[model samples]
Each structure stands twice: as C-alpha cells, then as structure tokens.
Target: MATAGGGNAHMVFRRYLDAVGLQGLASAEAAGLHTSEWYALSLITLEGSLSSGELASRTGLTTGATTRLIDRLERAGYARRAADPHDRRRVI
Candidate 1:
C-alpha cells in the first residue's frame, strides 16, 4: 500500500499533468502561442499588469527573454504595458 506521502506525491504529479494538458490545449487553440507565450499569459492572468522586470520575475524569464515575450504578446494583442503611473521612466 502506498504511504500518505507517496499518495500525495502521486496526486501532485497528476495535478501537474492535468494542468499541463489544459495549457497544451489552450496553446493549440491560440493561433500564435507556444509554450513560452502560454507561460507569459498565465503569469499575466495570475499577476495582472506588471512592469517588464516584474513580469520577468513572475515568469522566471530573464529581461531579454521577457522583452521577447512582451513583443509576442503585443503582436497577439494579449498584453501591453502602460506607462508607470508614478514613475515616468518605466512602463508597467
């Protein structure tokens, strides 16, 4: 019989797979979205509008990589960064 920890681990793995499967379906439905775009979208949905730096942190992306993701999102009309309300030096 599986121990409680083993059972929990199995459930966790199943949950992860389920989430991945859903993401895959969503990505396929999106005309131009691949895994990276999906990842960025998921982060934006969960975290709301963020500066490029903040978006990078939430998505586990480097600044350059995040910029690429933002470009994709912008092209796809999924995201945009507004100028920071308090700081004119940045977009959020």
Candidate 2:
C-alpha cells in the first residue's frame, strides 16, 4: 500500500534551507569575508565588541575557532583586538 505522505515536502524544505544558507554566504563574500567567518563577525558587529570567550558563547563556536576567526579578521584589517580600557589583559 502507498503512503499518503507528501513527496514535494522534503524538496521544499531543502530548497528553503539552501536558499537561506546561500544568501548568507553571498552576503559574507560581499562583506569581504569567507562565508565561514560571517557568523562570528555578524554577532560581534550587531552585538558590539566582546571578548573571545563571550563571542564564542554567543555564536555557538568553540573558543579556538572564535580565536581563529578573530585572527583572520585582524589579518584582513576588518577588525582588531583592542585592550579593554578597564582590563588590559583582555582583547576586546
């Protein structure tokens, strides 16, 4: 017996996800960054500067990955690590 499930549903869901992911990637490239770097930057830019640990928490990225992303941003001259006037030991 054939099931009554919808065949096109999966295609529609996948298309939606792909479309959103591609759009985000395109936006990242246009902003002078690798698509993989976009989420970190977007979080920082929208939420204001944050310590690497805090950024990692907000982005669901590990500390090391967040650090690497920050390094790339610095190397690209898109961002820089600054001393938090109140806490000279931390990069802001």
On lDDT, the leading prediction is: 2
Candidate lDDT scores, in order, read: 0.82, 0.85
lDDT, candidate 1, equals 0.82
Clashing pairs in 1: none
TM-score of candidate 1 relative to the true fold? 0.71
Which residue runs of candidate 2 sit more than 4 Å off their true CA positions? 1-18
76 Cα displacement, candidate 2 (Å): 0.8
lDDT agreement of model 2 with the native: 0.85
In the range 1-92, model 1's lDDT, one tens digit per residue, is 55566587789898999998997877746656877778778777887778889888877889999998899888889888788888999897
lDDT of 2 at 12: 88
Model 1: residues >4 Å from true position, as ranges?
Answer: 1-19, 25-31
Residue 43's lDDT within candidate 1 is 77
TM-score of model 2 vs. true structure? 0.71
**CA RMSD of each candidate after superposition:** 3.5, 3.7
- Candidate 2 residue lDDT tens string, 1-92: 55366668966887899999999999998988887688887777898889999988887889998899889998988778889999899889
